[model samples]
Target: MDLKPLLNKLEHYRSEKPNKVFTMYLNTDPADPDQQGGKWRLQLKNGLNNFESYLQEDGDSDEKRNYWAVKEKVENFMNENEMNLKKSVIIFATGDDDVWFADILQMPVKTAFFWEEEPVLDQLKEMQETFPKTGIILTQKDQIKYIDADLGTVNETNVYELDLDTEDWRLHQGTHKADSNLGSGGGKTSKKDEFYERFEANRYRWYKSIAPKLDKAAKNHGWERIYLVGESDEVNDLESHMNKTIEDKINKNLLDHEETKVLEEVL
Candidate 1:
């Protein structure tokens, strides 16, 4: 959810009198008690109708027609995406389609509507303040996962697995792959001890090798904050190696968990 371009556009947008921009922030989260019994459906209906009624009384024919055009588009958008709704839906539109923006957001928003000459952006700016672009780095013994998120929704995920044979961290498209075993014939405890000792000895070097990669990713994705989650020692080691400032560190191994669960736990 890159907000820069949208914010810039909306900030500079202004219409001559009689042409209004319609802004809507609808809370459609099913988990909310206030939204029980599909209350958002009724809210949407009334909100649009209320605007139409107000326009009919005080606005000219062009303004009424403009409101109707935007209203129809808003209704159609909601109808098509209702099944895929997340916590909220936001829309900024105009009758002539000179400016239109709609998104289903994982973060909840206060329901509000406005018909004005310019887009209403106070809520959106507040949301950006609350849920800035963030990067979550999950590290284990030999694997690292990066979750890039904006406005509380994951935008991309990248996985890097250390190739023991080549002693290099290789980027993979998705999450966990088959673990590289330590020894074929050995007591489990003994093998685990050996692996731990070996990793502890070279952890700094391995983390240092990947520090630049994380820095690059942060810059590329414009991560406003970075979080490191793993074993305490591992997290500390990685943090020390990275040049980027870490917003927080959680001493929990979450590489095996699903991405959503990882976010819930660490975020």
Candidate 2:
């Protein structure tokens, strides 16, 4: 899809009164060192690196270089670009306490998930009451899905599911297939095929049922931008496919499809 128009829109949004929005995907865990948390820190670092490069080329000579320094630089960049954090909406999807830092630092942020052990219903109620402006989402593995139905019609939420073959689906099952060829090869093939077909069919039905709800939620909440984080390769692939479908539909309708752009944190 042509992204120039979307880029222009984002530019306009950023310039038209400095509406700054920050979506921070946390990758660090305070308790686990061997988990994916460490890897997320690296991603954040890479974003910091990118920011540093931008600063060296276009920033002032006295720019700071420490952690807080980088944070200041980021804030400065937003200011320079006419992004107003107070007017912007910041979303965070985090599993650990790293998100608390942003709040502790008093950053203009609104968190989505903080990995609480509270019951889903309780959490939902609290979120609705406490963070009325933030969106409430449900995360399955790496895929982020919206699950708020009471606020609007079920048709408002957007659900997208990927249809995969037996082999692909099996990979996500986190199990190894037994060596059936040496034992019960004859009946296994047909059974496996049947299982896969059933699974794929069900997956499609569920996803199709859910996506529109998400779209409706976005509209009801007045969220101009939708961001997806921590999704798996399958979800990412599906998103890309959906974007193409959207682009095609928009083109057919004589409308413009704005490409979604992500600004990675530069280290």
Candidate 3:
């Protein structure tokens, strides 16, 4: 896509909301791209202020530390911006329970897509029941397709689906193409690579079909800024992988826009 125009538009918007704060979700999974090599820590070290840490001696301590560290950074950012406690957007990954906590705290909540798992669907259904007004965004193609099928209709009035490529925003660079990497198992040597290759390919296809819907949802929400906390590259490597930049995409796609700040760990 031609990104220069979008970049310029985002720059204009940034000039207007110099203090706006946006948040991104991070997948707390230790092996998630956002958590590898403690990259999220480095990204948040000096930026967050209000956060809670999980203290555990088991192998799960790392996970707890990561979650608390991010919470602290986000709290700090919110304080610094003096975000309207009621209007601030809190972005969460698919698996974080904190998403629900943020809502209880009275902060506005937004989420990325959760796929076909019945467990996740049940969780989503519960969340929707609790926060009927909350904004839940979807970017996975398969999830969108399933939702559309189940709903038996396409409603652009409230939800959004964008036409961008999910791979560009989700997968690590170069992992999408076919090669020997396609089926070589990374673990347990029995067709592992092949399994991952197929998995990656399927994910890529699904994302492509869903990006447009996500774009529409983001635009419809008229969010002033976006905050993300997740393991996916769309929430992690957004600045580098997507040529237009997050700030720009917000300007082009979101409403009442100003700036986009991502508080996330390096994936």
Candidate 4:
């Protein structure tokens, strides 16, 4: 969901004449829900009382009217909506149906409000969903999936699982020279080197194809960093072939996780 519009609305309020911001703070702790709510209920009542008294004493006409409407709107919201998981901190400006802002939190705050020119986003600090994250790449011989733990989302399909290559990328065993005495060991060594050259080349080709898609996903999918996780050989091989730009963004936090149960563990 987009919050830029609400943020823009907040900026509009900041620019309005006779500027005044109305804040409503609700403190809560999931550890002791009932008692925490009881404490904050009193704080809310007292904060509302302070706002009402401030409105009465205010000398500015435009701010007075706006805050008067804000006081009423805030009271209406409180009466109509219960303070639950998502409605941790709800702020409003006037009689508008939409609230100024709301934050989802599971942490404690000071439990207060300010009728000042500046709008506070202190609640954002306590919300994990608001923080930046790294894009986690889950890959194996068969699949490649991108997910972000901070945002709690996964791609619908694996990119590598799609049609890419039909050639064998795995190294195969080659027979050694029949005699231990030095003559044909060079032949054995040459065959082993050839197998590795082809195997490594194919792996790099696969990584080259997947890297650009990852770069696009990181740019468009909202992650500041990237991580790689899989078997050591695969992860390291992919890393070597990644674009330098993507390599710079990699956090290299190789997660030791099961590919089958990754979503459960990473999230």
Whose lDDT is greatest here? Answer: 1
Per-residue alpha-carbon lDDT of candidate 1 for residues 1-267, written as tens digits (9 for 90 to 100): 898889999999999757899999999999999999889999999999999998889959998888889999999999999899988999999999998899999888999999998999999999888788999998988888899988778888888877767778988765545465465565877887888898888889998998899999999999999999999988898899889999999988887888777777766
Q: TM-score: which candidate is best?
A: 1
- lDDT against the true structure, each candidate: 0.88, 0.32, 0.31, 0.53
Return the clash pairs for model 4, or none: none
- Which parts of model 4 have CA positions greater than 4 angstroms off? 1-19, 24-29, 32-42, 57-65, 71-99, 105-112, 121-130, 148-160, 163-207, 229-234, 244-267
Model 3 backbone overlap count: 45
TM-score of each: 0.93, 0.23, 0.22, 0.53
Preferred candidate (TM-score higher): 2 or 3: 2
Residue 6 of candidate 3: its Cα lDDT? 27
Better by lDDT, candidate 3 or 1: 1
Q: Flag the better candidate by lDDT, 2 or 4.
A: 4
TM-score of 1: 0.93
Stretches of candidate 3 off by over 4 Å are 1-195, 232-267
1-267 per-residue lDDT for model 3 (tens digits): 122332243333321111222234322233445556644444444333222221233345544555455455555654564433322223332123322222112222233322111112333334333432212222222222111111111122222232234333322121122133323335547565554565456654544444454445445444323333222533333323222213322112222111111111100
lDDT of 4 at 123: 53
TM-score (C-alpha, index-matched) for candidate 3: 0.22
The sequence of per-residue lDDT tens digits that candidate 2 reaches over residues 67-186 is 234355434443453322221222221122122123111112222321122211232233234322323232232123332222111212322323333222111221122232112556
- Summed backbone clashes in each candidate are 0, 25, 45, 0
Error of 4 at 55 (Å): 2.0
TM-score of 4: 0.53
